[model samples]
Target: MFTVIEEQEQRLLEIRRALHRHPELAYQEKQTSALIGKELDRLGISYAAGLAGGTGIRAELGKGTGPCVALRADMDALPVLEETGLDFASQQSGVMHACGHDGHTAMLLGAAELLARSTVLDEIGGRAALLFQPAEEAGNGAEAMIADNCLQDVEMIFCGHIDTHHPVGHLAVDQGLICSYADPFLIEICGRGGHAARPHEAVDAVVVGASLVLNIQTMVSRMINPARPGVITVGRIAAGAVHNVIAGRAVLEGTIRSTHPDTREQIIRRMQGVVRGLEEMCRAEISFTLHRGLPAVVNDPVSCALARQAAREVVGADQVISQGFPSLGGEDFSFYQQKIPGTMIRFGAAKDPSAGPAHSGSFDFDEKVLACGSRWLATVAVYGLRYLQKS
Candidate 1:
């Protein structure tokens, strides 16, 4: 199976580099979608473009009679500027493939090419649906694809993400809680403006906002159960315009993350209670808004076992690590799991310790993992489909 990917490794690298050079953001993946369509066309793979009511793509390869398995790759880039200094760095200003969606898209395309070859689909005994998803970073792509029936007739699904924290040959395949639920929030505090030197003349929104931030932090440490892990962070705050004037209004924006749904709900409820208390204590009005993001990525046991088996076959059993800590970061892949049994694996792509972390300006990895990822994705899709059909 790897030999197929190895044979097309150079072409895969070229495709990846080309995608890196022209990074697009969120739903604005026009060029990226076009490139994917062009590759699928060249490979003789039949596909439908403009899925999810936007620049998403879906392709299938195999006899249409058997169970179908879906493989997904996000096709969006971050807003970070390029600093990798690679010859194939981003050509667009203030946009870069800093989170490795470029590699994900390239590998999925390679998998489609390999799976669509003659006799491959027949041997697998089922069909493979390739999902080229957009706007994962902005967090609505999976929902949109689901709305577009991306998971129609799919029995099981598989996806993978490139992880720089792991070594180049390792694969992380935990059976539960791979990622956290992300909920973004905004808090607005309205108060009276006055001179900064006046101690008791007016209501100070800066003070109220500062208090609210600290109290919200305690929602995790004190309010929530110690056994349940949760996080609340205030990433941005805006208030007074002048140095000597007390702020009339202050806005706070941040994210909340949790591994459990109940914990997520608990934290939000506690946060609202805290805000209410602070508003009364400070004699001010406050408004809170929660933009519910993606859910925690919990792997289905059967699909996870299939993914592990595929990873061992593609790489080696020794290179497959089944136990790892769940990350606080959120993945929109979780949304797919809500509709069908699916698992998302982590492919090791870390090649340089000096390179910056994911979402950073100087992030990069060895291109060798591209072939590994492609093989793994293709193999897992086949294995998952066969398993689901038998079950």
Candidate 2:
């Protein structure tokens, strides 16, 4: 398997660079989706296009019957300008594959290239499903794909993310709570507007909003258990337009990330109490809107075992790591795991140890990870199917 991937290493590099040159945003991957389709066509891998808001593609390899395992890759870019000086850096201004989605997409395509030529699927009476999902950054792509029945008849699913923090060839395949549940919230405060000079006459929305932000920050420390990993971050705040006049309205946008459901609910309830108390004390109307986001990615132990087996085989036993701590970061891949047994491998792609993390303007990874990731995906798919058949 490694030899096959090595033979196509140059081809994979070209494909990843081609994708890196033209990054597309969530649900708007027209050219990216087209390119994937083109590659699938070349590999003679039949797939259905125009799904999941017209960007998700599902391709199948092997016989139509028997057990099936699926592998997924996200296709989307961040709204950040590129700063990497690489010749193949993103050509699209204010849009870059800063999070290694470009690498993820290319690796999945590389896996497709390998699986298309292999006979394991046929021998095991199984199939491999490849999903090129869009809008993972927007956090709804997985749901859209599921709505389109992308998980239909799929027994086990696997996906991977490029982790720049770890060296190339390492894979993190730990089971249970690998990622956090993300919940976004918006707080709007409405207060009486009056002359700035007459401080006694108006309720200052800015002051109330600022106080609310401070109070919300304390929820994690005061209300939620200190032992559990939880974060409440107010990322953006908007208030008065002018300096002289008292603002009538203010908006605060933030997110809540937690590992357990009890802790998440505890924070939400405490936030409501805090908002109510602040509103009563300041005589302002406060509205809190929390949008339920992706669930924590808790890998199934059985599925993770398959990933671990594949990772060990592809990159040796030492390169396969069992992560000790869960990430506060969220992933839409959790949506798929909610429906069926699934796990996500964090593939190490860091080319430089000091390089910036994902979503940074200069983020890039070692192209060598492409072959390793592809081999792991292909290997895991076959192993998952065999495991299912035996059970």
The best candidate in terms of TM-score: 2
- Candidate 1 Cα outliers beyond 4 Å, as residue runs: 5-7
Q: Each model's TM-score, in the order given? A: 0.96, 0.97
Question: Model 2: per-residue lDDT, tens digit, 1-391?
Answer: 5344455888888888999999999999999999999999999999999999999999999975899899999999999988888899888999999998988898899889888887778889899999999999999999999999999899899999999778888998898899999999999999988899997899999999989988887767777887888999998999888889999899999899999999899888899899999999999999999999989999999999999999999999999886668999999999998899999989987787545678888788888888888888899998899999998
Off by over 4 Å in 2: 2-7
lDDT of 2: 0.90
Tell me the tens digit of each residue's lDDT in model 1 across 1-391: 5455345998899999999999999999999999999999998888889988579998988875889999999999999998988999999999999989999999999888778764766865789999999999999999999899889898888999999888877888999898999999999999999998994988999999989987887667878876778899898999999999999899999999998889999998899899899989999999999999889999989999999999999889999985467888899999999988999999898877778999999999878888889889988987887786787
lDDT of every predicted structure (CA atoms): 0.89, 0.90
Model 1, C-alpha of 339: deviation from truth (Å): 1.0
Q: What is the lDDT of residue 221 in candidate 2?
A: 74
Which residue pairs collide in model 2, if any?
none
